[model samples]
Target: MKPRILYLATADARGHLMRAQLLAHALIERGAEVEVLTTSDEGATFLGEFGIAAEVLSRHYAVQFDERQNMQRGATDGNVARYLFDPRHMLRDIWRLRRRIAAVDLLVNDSFHPALLVMGCLPGWRRKIVHVYGASLRRALLDNFQGRLPNWLARGFAAAISSELRRARACLQHDFAYAAPARVAPRLFNLPTPIALAQLPQQVQGPRAAVYLNPHFRDPQLATGLEQGLAAMGLQALLVGEGYAGRAGWTPRDPQWIDAAAHSALIVSAPGMAALSVAQVYRRPILLLVTDQPEQRSNAARAADLGLVHEVVCWSGDARLFAIQVQEALQRLRAVAIEEGADAGSQRARQRLDAWVDCLLELAAEPR
Candidate 1:
């Protein structure tokens, strides 16, 4: 009998939904029945782009970000506190999940929703949950309380995170760069991003760039800067992301974005794990556009430390100044030669995917 899997994805960022889409597609190909539930309509729409149907959760909770894509800690804290304390709504969602999990053989929580986190820590559900998230996210959570909260509150928060992690059947933490897989904790394993390399279409290399940004980025000036910089370099580019749909010079979201990325001479995007993984897998040089967000900042720093990024561009608070920086960065990035060779990143990701699925099936087959 095929294992029925329930994947709960959080919509705080697009990376979580992307991971869910990739893993669910792999599971379906392996004859597993998979159902995806996401926290927001945005996530549902994103999954729809790749022909992956997902149900939007009724109780929505997302980390707040400012217009510039910077995480707003206070706003996020208030919303989370209200959502967790509101018994009428919180309990309704929790109970709904409780009923749903009864029918599934396994629950795959990607970066997780708060309600799902609560449910995973429950007596019966923890045995079925396999939590998947990027290491950067785990860092963000721990970094949130650093010197910002009272000592007691910080200790309590850390304990809560550890307790939740301890309850999960397994925890898979993915990284951006290639590294030897390791068992990080009692139930936690660290590996490369489980991207579907087989699905990435081969495209002829060209002197163009593929640019993508998530909806969380609402800086019009940054978009303008990107456009102007690419134009100044005389490079043909396809720009896609939230807030660029109806605008001139911006292309609609192409389902073949990975193909485009593979064909392009350069890849430009926010410091997202999905984009970074794709860049590495395709062996393409990527220019990271870093905002004030801690996750992005940290990711960019890591990529640089690992010598993965071709160039890094930080926002200078002025569109014109940023445009200049963009042009300079691209000029430098174009000069760097890309070596043609075997796809090591893709090979590693495929291996990780197989091992990930094996873990899932093994857990699902265990006697309850």
Candidate 2:
């Protein structure tokens, strides 16, 4: 019998959907039945672009962000509070999710969602639940509650987080680097970013830049500044992101973006796990466009410490200054050495994916 799996991916950014799509395709290839549910219509659209069908889960919540991509703490808190107070909507989705969970052999939650996190604590849910998220996200969560909140509230938050982690059958925390996987805890595994690449057609590195911005980045001037910076650097830029799709100089969504990025002279993107993984895998120099978001800020700092980032760009409400930073970063990145072939990085990604697939199959086959 085929192992049946349900995947719930949050749509705060496209990275979650991208990971879900990749894992869904892989599991299907491995003879498992897979169903994907996303938190928002935007996630469904993103999956649709890649020829993947997804259903939108109702009453899903997302963290709020500002126009410059800064996380809005008070707004997000209010949104969550509203959702928590709406028992009708909350219970409706929870009941729906519970039924789906019972039907599937396993439920994989990519990143975190309030509905799944709530369901995870219920009886009989842990044996069938597996959590996947980036390491930086884990760090940011810890940072949020440590010495930043009231002592009693911080402890309460920490305890809730601990409870959720304990409830999961396994936690797959992925990070950047071409390193060996390690067992961080009895049920937690620290693995390389589970990115699988397709065979690339023979192509040489070109004098072009590949750029991607998530939907959270809403500043129009940043987009304008990016163009000016690339122009100044004498590099043609191929921009891909849902946020900038219809804008002038922004290209339509291309499934072959990985190929373009692999062969480009430089890569530019927000320091999301997906972008960072791609940069490391292809051994391409990257300029990280960071914002005040804790997860992204942590990722940028870590990447720089590891010598993985070639440059870092932060917007201070100055488009001209932002452009100048980008230009200088690109110039510096040009001098860095890129490996002739990405055999090592590809191997690491493949290994991570294989490990995840193996774990899923193993869990699915276990006795109920």
Instruction: Please list the C-alpha lDDT of all candidates, in the order they appear.
Output: 0.79, 0.80
lDDT (C-alpha) at residue 143 in model 1 = 67
RMSD in angstroms between candidate 2 and the native structure over all alpha carbons: 2.0
Query: Per-candidate TM vs. native?
Result: 0.93, 0.94
| Segments in model 2 whose C-alpha atoms lie over 4 Å from true places | 145-148, 201-206, 342-345
Report lDDT (Cα) of residue 108, candidate 2: 85
Model 1: per-residue lDDT, tens digit, 1-368?
99899998888887788778888888888888999999888779889998789998664477988767778889988888888888866777888888889999888888856776777788898888888888887777766787888988987897888678778788888887756567777678887776656344454444789898887777788888888899899888878887567778776466677667765788999888888877777778898988778777778888877767578888877889888999999999888888654356557668877866776776677765
Among residues 3 or more apart in sequence or in different chains, the pairs in candidate 1 whose N, CA or C atoms overlap within 3 Å are none
- Per residue, candidate 2 scores C-alpha lDDT tens digits across 103-130 of 9998988877777777777788777888
TM-score of 2: 0.94
User: How large an RMSD does model 1 have?
Assistant: 2.1
Distance (Å) between predicted and true CA of 158, model 2? 1.5
The deviation in Å at residue 348 for candidate 1 is 4.3
